[model samples]
Target: MATLSYAAKDSRTMVRRNLKKALRYPSLTLTVVIMPIMMLLLFNYAFGTALGSGIGPSAAGGGEYIDYLAPGIILMAATSGALTTAISVCVDKTEGIVDRFRTMPISRASFLTGHVVGSVIQTMTSITLVIAVALLVGFRPDATPVEWLAAIGLLALLTLALTWLSAGIGLVAKNVETASNIPMPLTFLPFIGSAIVPPESMPAGLRWFAEYQPFTPIIETLRGLWLGTGIGSSAAIGLAWCVALTVVGYLWARRTFKAGAKR
Candidate 1:
């Protein structure tokens, strides 16, 4: 019980520290807020009509594609948030902060929890901002209350998975710059998947990868929730991916951090 209490207090302290750091660097939060909104507007206006022909019409009924595109954009916001976590972790390690913390009696997991929890909170806020903008720009969905809750759940799950993965990447990176770049592939994954254009149009090699990769199933499930499209096994597959990534990332991050402390 005492150990549990210490863990809780440490997690909260780290979470507060991370949040305060973000507040100090207001641009971080601003970027988190603006990037997703900009992406939503850019894609919805510049490419919505063109892409709608390929991705399918909105289930809210019309050829308009913003509805179909909004979910993917929201998820993309989570990706952006994950990048911030990687950068923060990398910065901490590069500055010898992690080594300093190792000398203290605080829980080791506190550092990871603080970044992950704070990042997830910030990412969800960004996602909320994107959703509001998407609605203003004519995105619509026929989801019920339960479906909306489920959608939020899925986003949380995805965010947690990606956050842990980013945390791992951050810990393993040799420098802040390298850590920032490590998660770049995740940011680009949506593009190759069913995010903007359909995978069907890609050449065979890229098409096969996009079709079979993890992002497609996750996107497909999000698309299904928002637009009343077919989910099929995408929901199950997405959940499995989230679980697998979270487990792998958590293990990797803990191991890496412990190993780094030894060095």
Candidate 2:
């Protein structure tokens, strides 16, 4: 019960801290909000048609490329924000803020919890902004309210998983600059998957990666939910990826935290 209480309190405190920071720096918050929207607009309007043409008929089949790309953009936004989380945590570490927290009576989990919760909230905001812009640009999910909720739930899970992974990197990184670079590979993953184009049309080797990769399942699951299609293997694969990443990230973060505490 003590552990659970710590987790709850830490989550709340982290949320509060992040909200205060965002409120104090409205322009920074606005920049975060605009980046994804701009990316989506540029991709859909400027390059989507040109890219869609190369992917063949199935790519442009539904005439709803924006809807098709929404999930990917959402994932990308979440991934992008995670780098900020890592950099912020590293900044805190460098400024001796984390060391100060360590000396206080605060629960160990609370320190990490606050950052994770804050990062997740930021990711959610980015996701929502991207979705809103997608709607404006002609993207609509056919799912019911419940399905929409599930889709959001999946997105939240993915955000948390990635955030935890980023946190681990932040804890052990030698400097702020390197910490910021850790999540770039994750950010580019969805692009290589079926997010922008179907995997079927790719070369054999590229198709193999697309078929077996975690991003494909995540994109497919979101796409299936949006289109009201049948629940398929993609959902299972996505869940498996989340669970695996969560476990691995937890262990790595714990180890990194322990090592940093010693230092």
Candidate 3:
């Protein structure tokens, strides 16, 4: 009981440390917010009409392209912040910060916990900003209060899972550049999913991949919750993906951290 309490305190301290670092150097956080807003504007104003027509009437939630595109772009906001986690972790490792932390009388678990918690907070803030922009640009959803809560919960879960994965990547990366590039696929994977267009519009091979990928179900679930579309089994599948990813990431990061500590 006492140990758990101490661990919690240590983790909070680390979270504060990371959050302060982020405030002192706001570039990464700004990028996380800006990139999604850029994509949202580009797609909504530049190609909205053409793409909206291409997606057909039913797929666009019977409304403008922004309505259909908002959920996916919001998910992009959640993902775009992942790169910062990997880079920060790598930078700490390369700068011998981890070595210094090891000598401190702090909970070892708090190191990664701090990074993940701090990141989730920052990423969620970015998501909120993106959502505000989305609303400003006519991205309206018919979601109820309960649905909004559920959607927020799911986004938080996804952010936590991705942050852990980024931590693992940082642990194993040979350099900061490698760490930064490794999570790039995650940032853009939504484009290949049901983000912009439905899988029905894709060729057979690409459609198969898009349907089975993790992001598609998640986006579908969000769409259903926000736009009154059919969720089917997407909510369950998305939750499963979040749990599976979180488990895998946690195990991988724990193992890698332990190995580094031993060496």
Candidate 4:
């Protein structure tokens, strides 16, 4: 019980420290917030006439496409937040902070927990900001209040999973540059999924991969929740992916942290 209490307290402290860093360096958080909105506007305006037509008539123009596009961009914001976690973790490891902590009597999980919790909170905020901006730009979801809560729940789960995955990537990275590069694929996932264009319009090969990848199911589930199409198996698959990734990420990250303990 004492050990558990120590772990909990340490984790909480780390969470506050990370949040303080985020507040101290507002630019990084600002960048995470702005990137998705920029993507939302750019895609909605610059390509909405051309690409929006492909999604459906409602998506063709007059900002109707923003409705279709909002969920995916919100997911993209989560990806951006994950990248921040990766970079921050890598910096600490590379700068000797992780090593110093290893030499201390700190709770083993606390260091990583701080980062994961902080990133989750930050990502959630970024998602909210993006959604609000999307609303301002005429994005609308027909989901009811309950459905909206459900969608937020899904987003929160995704944020937690991605942050942990990013933490693992950062921990295993050889350097800060490598850490930054490792999580790049996550941000690029929006392009390959149903975000920019529907998967049905893609080539058979690309379509197969897109439909099977973790991001597509998540995006599809989000779309279903927002548009009232029913999440169906997409929600199951998305949740499975989130659970699997969270488990794998936590395992590997815990191993990595304990490996440092042995050093």
Q: Pick the candidate with the highest lDDT.
A: 3
Off by over 4 Å in 3: none
Q: Give lDDT tens digits, candidate 2, residues 1-263.
A: 98888778866886798668767866645665676777788888998887767665344335466766777777777777777678777878888998988897777777677877887887798788888888888887777889889889988988888888988988888799889788778877887888777788799999999889888888788877887544578899898998888788778877788778888
lDDT of 1 by residue, 223-246 (tens): 788777889999999999989989
Off by over 4 Å in 2: 2-7, 26-32, 54-61, 229-231
Instruction: Show the colliding residue pairs in model 2.
Output: none
In candidate 3, the residue pairs with backbone N, CA or C atoms under 3 Å apart (3 or more residues apart, or in different chains) clash, namely none
Native-to-model Cα distance after best TM-score fit, residue 209 in candidate 1, in Å? 1.2
lDDT of 4 by residue, 1-263 (tens): 99999999999999999999999989878988899999999998898777767677543233367777888898999888888999899889989999888779889789999999999999999999999998898877777888888889988988888888899889888898898888888987978988888788899999988888898888878888787655679999999998988898888888887786676
Higher-ranked by TM-score: 1 or 2: 1
Rank by lDDT, descending?
3, 4, 1, 2
Q: lDDT at 220 for candidate 2? A: 81
lDDT of 2 at 27: 65
Per-model TM-score on C-alpha atoms: 0.95, 0.90, 0.99, 0.95
- Model 2 clash count equals 0
Q: Residue 253's C-alpha lDDT in candidate 1?
A: 89
Residue 226 deviation, candidate 4, in Å? 1.3
Rank the candidate models, highest TM-score first.
3, 4, 1, 2
Stretches of candidate 1 off by over 4 Å are: 54-63
Of candidates 3 and 1, the better by TM-score: 3
